[model samples]
Target: MKSIKSAGVIGAGVIGSGWIARLILNGIDVCVFDPSKDAPKSVEKVINNAERAYKNLLRSPLPKKGVLSFLDTVSEVAKSSEIIIEAVPERLSAKQSVYKEIELNASNELIITSSTSGILPSDLQSEMKNPERLTVAHPFNPVYLLPLVEVVGGSKTSQKVIDETCSIFSNIGMFPLYIKKEIPAFIADRLLESVWREALWLVNDDIATTEEIDDAIRYGFGLRWAQMGLFETYRLAGGEAGMRHFISQFGPCLEWPWTHLMDVPEFTEELVDKVSNQSDDQSGKHSIDELMQKRDDNLVDFLKVLKENRWGAGNTLKEFDDSLGNSRIDFSELDVSKPLKTFSTHIPKDWADYNGHMTEARYLDCFSEATTELMAIIGADEEYIANIGSYFTVETHIRHLDEVLIGEGIYSKTQVIYGENKKLHLFHWLHHNDGRLLATAEHMLIHVDLKTRGASMPGDSVIEKMERIYSAHKNLPKPEGLSRAVGDKV
Candidate 1:
């Protein structure tokens, strides 16, 4: 619930637009200033990409988006915003001038953050009148999905500014790694620079093509790096003895010239042509937008799998998801006497086929979520399940009546058929936003012991809640497709 009142973004290129999208999506109004004619288009594109990924990634309700306004000048943007983000070009003079303008129009209370990739925060803040409020909150490309942000404070910056920046970033679902000592290219980029330098050498020397180098990372160490990271990964690789033993085994290899560490390669036109052509050959078929879509889809699936296991980035997403759920409408507000409005969402692009129609499996996915929400209504939340037990779906019957397209808003209202003893039978009616019945799902679930994996008696408290709902629903007419088997007429 803690968030800033408003934010301002300067230079709506890739990074600036990304900040705008992330800020606005988290419900902070934004004033933007970008002199480029294409700034508006670029901002909307990033927002579109963010929205598409969010729909597939988070299961909870999203906060209402904040208002976005484009101001005529950088001074106007700074004057209107509580926080100012400078994401202009990397030139020192360009950044200093922007900071100077921001300081002139804004109060000393307004915090200023830079999205610089390699510039030191000290240099970034040196030109500002109130440099104490300056810090570097550098983020990776595709900022919405990737959670890591480097929060670096300059020598003149206040501890308050740094702390507040971290809090603001964390609220917007970012893991702000505080850099205690100001350094050029913070942390992640320093590591990335090493890899990039080596990759360039490999390409320049004809050791590997762009595709080959990409394949090695994507198919090999990249997978390990995503979950465990370097030192921890190597520690595991050390067999039973761990890090010390690993060093004993592989320390000698450091002396060998396996990489082109700091031996800088000449960036001749020939080298540039080679790298560019190779990259083109590798991914030339797909447009920039297509490449972005693929990257987002892959990341969403990875994060979803990690979430199920409660590991790595999954934990961060789970925390954000819980926060969203906490901010949502309470389940008790619903009338237990009627079919409950259990689940609702616009179908994400990832859920659709090439034709843009939602696939068959996603139908079951929607129903599963509806069933989960119903369980939550009847005292089967995570805490309850951990202490006691919960219901498990044993059977399902789904009738896909009408086709639904990607981006189409849909919802399900679930009715309790039988909510007593070990059995919990339910029926869900899925409807499009236009009032057409898109589908219906009938499910039967069993309450079970987590320890034994066998059927168990329902807890008295849960049974009491279920009994009340069942009593209220018992008088309703039976659903049309209830108990119907496949190939049987409804």
Candidate 2:
């Protein structure tokens, strides 16, 4: 996939700011134009949240941060960018004006995209001189974290543009779902609209409060939906009999009045007040900032869990991780002559102790993460564990060299002290961003067959790579605390 190095964003509201955040984090420079005075703060807020969530959710090192600029006009943003993202207000006239400016200022090579939630791309491209370059790249809110993007093309949109958009998005750690048939609201939003209609009716009729409806989802089917979509999950209900049999038994329910989805309740002022009051009652205590933090934290944790299990959205995250491995320094392909800097991330607030410095357990976590990456570098990944064998840490020594304050960035450099047959020895130095040594850990690992759980020889691939690393690292002075135990001086 050809990477998009520079992008232009036309607005900086919730969706526009999200696009800017996602783009810049992937190391793409962005120029944005939004007339509102709050645009800068909005983008900054989203970027901060995105950085926090990404540092927490992803273990791999991120690419170098990109440059961001705020421009006075759409023409300025369009002329400077390889791709133009129109995230203006959803109104047709507002969007059309932006497109006209883009056509006048941008080169024909530019790829122009819209972030409209439901507006058809055909309508958006109708007044464009380069309609073929224009497509709807609808993304969900908090776009930095969510991977799904719906790439829909209008009648004049070339397949080349659609393919290019998907490739660019995928390269930047997004799943660009090429929506073949353009329709109102696209796919996922349509599904959401059904539930939304039903929920609104439920609230209007006083059958359920806003909080209760949310509870029904988050507590019940929401978990299932995360890993398996609606149909696949329902397919499980069929059991050994299969979906056909399950449908035979329960499909008739669709004919029944189980849903108010077919009709939307009157959107009256009273109904709005009812929902507003109930929603406020449910979560008015938390500021929007607080709610956004909670949302990002919860989503990141859930993604991490899913990543561990390699399911659903988690699978997408893992693939994205694979793509972004060593974004700052490619670990698998690094020079073995030096200590390998395999991991880097900020010390999130949750990792801190009461005194506001990084706590002890997280030290082990950071070391283990670096070790795991080293293991993968030598052919001991999850697939290897499932099929062949893996290295199990048998012993560890950690020295606290200095304090890592909350929000401080830290990184690790690894040394292979010994690698032969069944045993492997590792030394990791955790360094603060400013070059201070924060901590050090030495680990002893034994390769074990998964079936027997006994010490065993790893594959030649693993042994060979480890030997190479060990050979290169043997000449370097031993790590300061190479074999030091607890309470021992360095």
Candidate 3:
């Protein structure tokens, strides 16, 4: 399969713009064609939001964003693209015309995909000349953060096309699940539709308000679903007996009239008004933009937790980070005798406290990031942490020297004070952009075998590098706060 380096998007609606953001963030040049007068503005808004989310979502350094181009015609976009994704409105005739245009303008080798939520792939490919290149690559909203994408092939679609499409999506940090058979709505949407239908019925019957329904999911099973799907979650409910036991225990509920899955309530004006009014009441204080920002922030925190645990969506993020390759700065040319400038970043609004300045604990976070950078420079990167060994902070001493307000840029310079086979002593000085020292940290770390959870010496090469850095800093004048105890001299 050819590597995908450039892509074309046929629409600049929500899904299309999201695809554009994901592709560009993954370093794929994109050309977009959408005739809507407001396409440029809307797509630009989505891109901005996506960039903000990415800063918090990704821990590893990101590649330079690919160039984005707006084109006047579908033929123009298709000519320059290796993959053409159609995210036009969900109409059979409209989508068929898009496929026809793409087929005429693009090469036979070009991969063509549709982001239709439920339309069958075979129906979509019916009007195309080379239908074998067409398939459904359905993705969820906020595509840049969510990893799931259902790749379903039509009857005429080739296995090679499916495999290559999966590879391309995976390259862009997505988890592509191949559907063995083409079905309307594929997998995720079908499940979502079922819940949505039930939710509507509950509201229609006045059994639950819209906010209550949302609370039911967001406060309960929704958390479990992030890491474990329905069946797996139920398996645990069986209390050690597992899936079969759980089914036997709750099997009778299937026959019970507990759910109205087969029937759906009509979308009457009264029901719509009731649901809308309740929804407005529940979230009237926040605009759509605010809600979107909040959602993205929560997702970032959730995914970070998952990444640390190496489970679910976090695993996908970890794999993506590994694929991004090393982006650490080359410290070889620096004068090791002085403090090595390792990390710098702007303080985000979320890091501020009630006083509108950076919170106390966030200082530690800044220092920790600097320590990670220092480790990466000394060869304790992702591979070393996974396979060989890693340094764990055993003790930390933080002294706050000055206050840093929100939006201020801060940097840290680290020096290796001591190093041995299994022990490392380090200090970091945090400073504001104005050259004022904000804080300082002293940390003691121990190298440990990840598998054994015991202290272990790192490889000889890493040790040698640490020794050199230690030697460089041995004679440098120590900072005033070094080795000071928290007590007044009598």
Using all chains and alpha carbons, the TM-scores for the candidates as numbered come to 0.83, 0.86, 0.79
Residue range 258-346, candidate 2, lDDT tens digits: 88776888889999999999999999999999999999999988888899998888888998887777443344666999998867878
Error of 1 at 224 (Å): 2.6
Order of candidate numbers by TM-score, starting with the best: 2, 1, 3
> Taking the tens digit of each residue's C-alpha lDDT, what string does model 1 give over 239-326?
8999999999999999998988878799999999999999999999999999998999899889888888998888888988878765
**TM-score, candidate number 3:** 0.79
Instruction: Assess the local accuracy of residue 273 in candidate 1 as a C-alpha lDDT between 0 and 100.
Output: 96
Question: Which candidate's lDDT is highest?
Answer: 2
Candidate 3 minimal-lDDT segment of 10 residues: 322-331
lDDT of 3 by residue, 189-282 (tens): 9999999999999999889999999999999999999888899899999988999999999998899897888998988899889989999999
How much RMSD separates candidate 2 from the native structure?
3.6
Strongest candidate by TM-score: 2
What are the candidates' C-alpha RMSDs?
3.8, 3.6, 4.7
